[model samples]
Target: MGPLQIKNILQTSPENQSVTVKGWVRTKRESKNAIFIALNDGSTIHNIQAVAEPGQFSAELLSTVTTGSCLKITGQLVESQGSGQAVEVKIDDILVYGTADPESFPLQPKKHSLEFLREIAHLRPRTNTFSAILRIRHALAFAVHQYFNDGGFFYLHTPVITASDAEGAGEMFRVTTLDLNKLPRTEEGAINFKEDFFGREANLTVSGQLEGELGAMALSKIYTFGPTFRAENSNTTRHLAEFWMIEPEMAFFELEDNMNLAEDFVKKVITYALIHCKDDLNFLQNRLAEEDKNKPQNERSIPLLEKLSFVVDNPFERLTYTEAIEILLKSKPHKEKKFQYPVGWGIDLSSEHERYLVEKHFKKPVILTNYPKEIKSFYMKLDEDGKTVRAMDVLFPGIGEIIGGSQREEDYDKLLGRVKEVGIDPENLWWYLETRKFGTAPHSGFGLGFERLVLFVTGMSNIRDVIPFPRYPKSAEF
Candidate 1:
């Protein structure tokens, strides 16, 4: 058989069986008679101990087996005499595949600051914290597809380059092949997009929701999980220039259906992580506890595992935006002017407002619906009062708005009017408008930032840490 992964080796019974394990050396200790090497293959958070007699290997070879060195070790598996671990390997043969110079290697079995890790993102995955986080991230991603597949939702691939601005926010990365040095110009002296690659202005899509809605119209249920881009220059903990999104659109679903689906989806995935990624989650929970110890008692976050359990066990509180506003107005923080931004009916709710509802007031996940039309996207179904739209936002404790979605307006005239009001040319979105004109159905969908979900589950403070390579303002290093 091929070399077994460390994860499996650590779980097997010691029958004095000979096995070969290949992994990087995490730590090495030398003593008078024996050498102990802690090795990890990134199969799991735990490392396997490999014990070697002083004369088992050449002195030069043993000296090169420092931290971060790659090795292929053949040994007899036996019950460990160590206090913490259950099993260990008694090395019979060893080969050095590669060596990391301990004098210059960055990770040396020491605690590292998150900011410093960001600089060495390419190497951070070798660390325990990142390896555990990456494992949980994989679990969560698998759970997302599995849940949708079990629910009969078709996975649709949408175009990354689109002309239509889904959010109408004008914050998009322009896609062009035209030479900037000598750009073609129209008679009006404007940079002519007519000579561009797609024969018009094109950009990286801000969402797949619009295309997802098209699939849902015919397929009944559809979902999209892919990269989306934004050109916003904001440098904050919550912002990323490029990130992954999970969008699920369903036909014949109203506002209540949308809210219910979002809640169940979130709870199901978090539960999956709890069950499948127990070891990784336990590591993260401990890490979060250490982080919380430094903050003031009142400012510290709830324990990671407990917070996740709370979300899964309890039903999310559902309330309308108007009702949410009234509650906020009566809140002690509002009266004391503790919020950085003022809260009112027409204004869009900020992260501070969302956390107040989830962390302080409701003390659970919250689904706030029926936001004012001005603050929501144009496709949301406008209420009969013509003031609000059927929009919903899912709020979590540490992270604010984890999901945003709405029931779409099936009325073509209203959608067209809103498109005009939002300053988008009707001709640009003619195909989208045609859908509303032809076979329109009551549909709803929501967007979940994939990194944000990982951040919450991993108990990570910065959104940058959860994702493998973070893309942000003026920084695109791999």
Candidate 2:
């Protein structure tokens, strides 16, 4: 028979029943007449204790059972006499699969700093903190698919390599096969991209919204969940060179319907995690509490579980961007000269302003809509006022701008004019322009940074800690 996972063994009434288990050894201690070992298999944060009698196995075999060692044990599951655990295994035989030397291993039995663990990304998953985080991450991802499926949304796979930039930021990683040693050039002394792999300039996609719109035009409702790349050289806690995005587009939907869907979707996913990941969340809650003890009293945050419950139960505040700008102008921060960026009518809102609105003024998530057209993407639906577009940004308490989306312009002439106004050639986006020409409906969608959701749900301060392997400006090791 196959070996049972430690999680199932602990929950089952397998007392006096022989079972085989395989996992890595987390810790080992020698008693007067027995050897006690804590075994973990990444199934749960809790470890199952395994007790071996003296002389049950050879001394040489037992000596190699240090921290991080892999082993297979055949034993009878019995009630544990220990204080924390409910059940344990009484080992009858053991086989060492691999041994980890105590003197050379980086992960010891003590608590390690998150910054230190990041250097060894490959081995960090074996730690308790990382293990719990990864489990919660998986649960959140499952909830994403479940929520969308229940809402009758089709999953669409968008292309990773494309000839157009959806955001129009021009910050994209180039994909080329041309050799720099011997490059082809035009008569104008410019590099000839026609000789490249795609016969023109191609890049890793910055956003999948454009392709998702094409699918939505036919399928009515579709979503894309995949990796995206950016070439920005930002080395902050919030920036990553590569990340996952969740973008959902729907045909025949307006700006109000888009905002309603975004709110419902976020609440559903968070509620799912609260019910399914109680233990892991509790561990993280306590960990954050301990860390908060050293900080100033005013800077400490509320309990993690309570904060999550508040978001799930309450309704998000909604207002126009112009109203938000007015509030910021009269606020204490602006009067006291605290804001680094000036607050005005047409300027783009910075992170500090976003956090202040959600964390200080409203004290909840806020959806600000109708941003100035010059500050937003060209494809956003133009407002009747001719100065603003139907753009909305969802701001969470700790994390600012968790989602950004807008209603797409359906008028071909207006969209083409906006495209030209943004300095992009209309000929280059012939396909997207054609969608509006033939049969375009009033569609809208938003892009949610998957990592930011994980970061907010797990109560993690840094974005890197939530992802398994983080890619940043100068670091891509492992």
Candidate 3:
């Protein structure tokens, strides 16, 4: 009949007040006289302990209410019998609307493997770890919008389907309406895939950075937050077939300005999640620390709030890609790994190299700039060396490369030349080059791997765990 949140109840002014609460049973304990149930409502991180006497509600009635069963209860909020909690509910009435059987259901008291949990993605949120992850995910999302919005950046909705692959990763999943059995044939003998959809070979966008750049050119500042697809075959936890990206584009900005945006943006995200998701973070803290009560404090102090302050207050260490390579060559951590690529001045830094730079060398998030032209995308502005591009990847302590962005090749001839050099048809990027043709103002931006950011904020290791309904390789169900 009434709505009450466990958090609100716990903070009630009148301690012994009566309240009505509705939620699903998380865990239940049976006794000869009374039955205890921990009820979890999605509104809060905490669950209310409900004590219902078997004497009043028949044993059969109590039996019907199992873990995962939905219920509404009218109860007096009294102090808890256990030392762990301050208050609990003394149930006066109970309504068991829905029930779940322990035998047939998925969740149980025992710990389930991450692989097993991935199978039941939909129901994973009810678990503590997933709940914390999703909470941090949402908090970080809001933080991203707030960070951009506070700075007067316009929120732009970029197209999900585009004829152009923004990242030029060749990882796009094509969008086609043409029937496979009945293919359209042009004068050429090749299959006319261009006949599909909007009369061209369109596919899911790999990044919205290109479109975001256009918005920035007009609005000065703009950002896009949405799903982007990558059909890359690598099946690592760091790679996802479908993922979200936050790309903030700015006009009248160059490489240094772009790095400042990224540094501030990363801090804002961490700051917001730490502030807004305190309860959820603390949940992780307690869960992780409880495993080893004697564990060192430094290793366990990973919740966003405790560590984010230091990161936000400090300026990110900036090192050129060449400098980073030099440091990696001379670094002790790299000595142990015997890096697969083996460090070289002109070589692209591997994830391992980036980790050594951020995690061991700097011991914080770092920006490595001016990568070799050969390894970077075509859109990056050319550097003075005439060999390297203006591309940069923001490497965080735990998550190596969280962002990839660069100043656009604003020179009309340079862009066209780069397009030709990259062997992509210049026609596909005609409109992109048009921005440069029509008074472009040295715009720059970067794409933060939203899942990786979420992972960083929540101290979650796997990218798959951060995204709900994760679309990893051979994984589309649950």
Candidate 4:
């Protein structure tokens, strides 16, 4: 028979059939007459118990089968007499594939701080917490593709390196092969980028929206799920130097259509996770509850499952940025002078402001639209009054802005003017602008940070914790 995953084996009814299970030992308890070993193979959050009689195996083998040790146990499946599980394997033979020294193994079947687990990231996946998180992460990623594919949206691969700055944020990681010690200088005493690998200048892409839009202009609907880099030296729980982005662009889609699609898309994916990753979600929910126990009542968050269900069940509260600002202005926190930053029109909304709107006022997901042009990207379509743009930010209860997007400027002259107004070199974006000149129909797209979504779903407080290998300021350790 094929190797059975622990998940399937655990689900199998006890028919007294012979089976072989291979996995790492989570914990082992030995008595005078019996030994119980909890084994997991990264298949599920739960572990399968394997029982062996004393002297059934060599003392050396039993000693080696400690915590974190790899083992293959062939046995008879029987109805479990244990309290926690339904099925247990009555082992007839045991093989030790690898052994982890009990003393050296950082994970010793105890509660570990998230901070400590991050230090040993290579082995963190073996922990119940990280394994559950990774399983849920995979479910969400799969749901992303399945959702788009079922809706006729093609998966488009965007470039990692590009000549243009998509966000124009000026926080790009420079890509060059020029010798740093021996420099190439131009006549103007500037570093000559012409001698670099790309011949002019290039850097890692910040977003795939620009290229995804190009695909949408032709393919009707396209989505890009890939890594994007930012050179900003931010050392916060929310910021990462390298992260994955999910950007979907559509042709002939106005701001309203974009909003509808985004709301539906997120709800669908979250729903998928709820259905496919029920066990992992339950584990994370319990984990979050335990973590919140030490915090003040006001500081504690809503239960993970409840928060997710609320998002999926309710229609998001939609309002303009102006309306949201009006609400914040009249809020108790604002009136009591509790806001950390000043709030008014034409100002960028901070996380506090967003949280207030979603967690306090609406108590649900909030979609704020029509942001002032000055605070948003240049490519966003301008409004008739020549001030606000048709931008939208989807705010979750815990996550400030889960998704940000806008109706792109289809007018060539207007787009060109805004491009120059923002100090972006028009010549550098000629190709993107040329789309507006030729066949650009009204298109709208949004970018969702993959790690942020995982953070929300897994109930992970730190962005670094959700991603396996987090890249941040001053740290890129494996």
lDDT of 3 by residue, 1-478 (tens): 3476766777775477888888888889978877888988776688888887768788788887887888998889888887767888899999988988878879876687778898899888888788778877888888888888999999999999999987667888988899988889888877787677788888999988888888988999999999999998877878888999888888988999999888887887787777777888888766655544666765553544545565777778897888887898788766776777777787767788887776666877788888888898888999977888898888876567888989878888888888888888988888888998898678898888888877767766578888998997787886
Q: Give lDDT for model 4.
A: 0.94
Candidate 1: global Cα-lDDT?
0.94
Clashing pairs in 1: none
lDDT of 1 by residue, 111-204 (tens): 9999999999999999989999899999999999999999999999999999989998999999999999999999999999999999999999
Q: Is candidate 2 or candidate 3 better by lDDT?
A: 2
- Per-residue error for 463 in candidate 4, Å, reads 0.5
For model 2, what is the error of residue 345's alpha carbon versus the real structure, in angstroms, after optimal superposition?
1.5
Residue 113 of model 3: what lDDT? 74
lDDT of 4 by residue, 1-478 (tens): 6698999999899999999999999999999989999999999999999999988888878889999999999999999987999999999999899999998989998999999998999999999899998998999999999999999999999999999998889999989899999889999999999889889999999999988989999999999999999999998899999999999999999999999999999999999999999999999899889889999999898999999998999999999999999999999999999999999998899999999998889888999999999999999999998999999999998889999999999999999999999999999998899999897699999999999999999888999999889899888989
In angstroms, give how far residue 160 of model 2 lies from its true place: 0.5
TM-score for candidate 2, residues paired by index: 0.98
Clashing pairs in 3: none
Clashing pairs in 2: none
lDDT of each: 0.94, 0.92, 0.82, 0.94
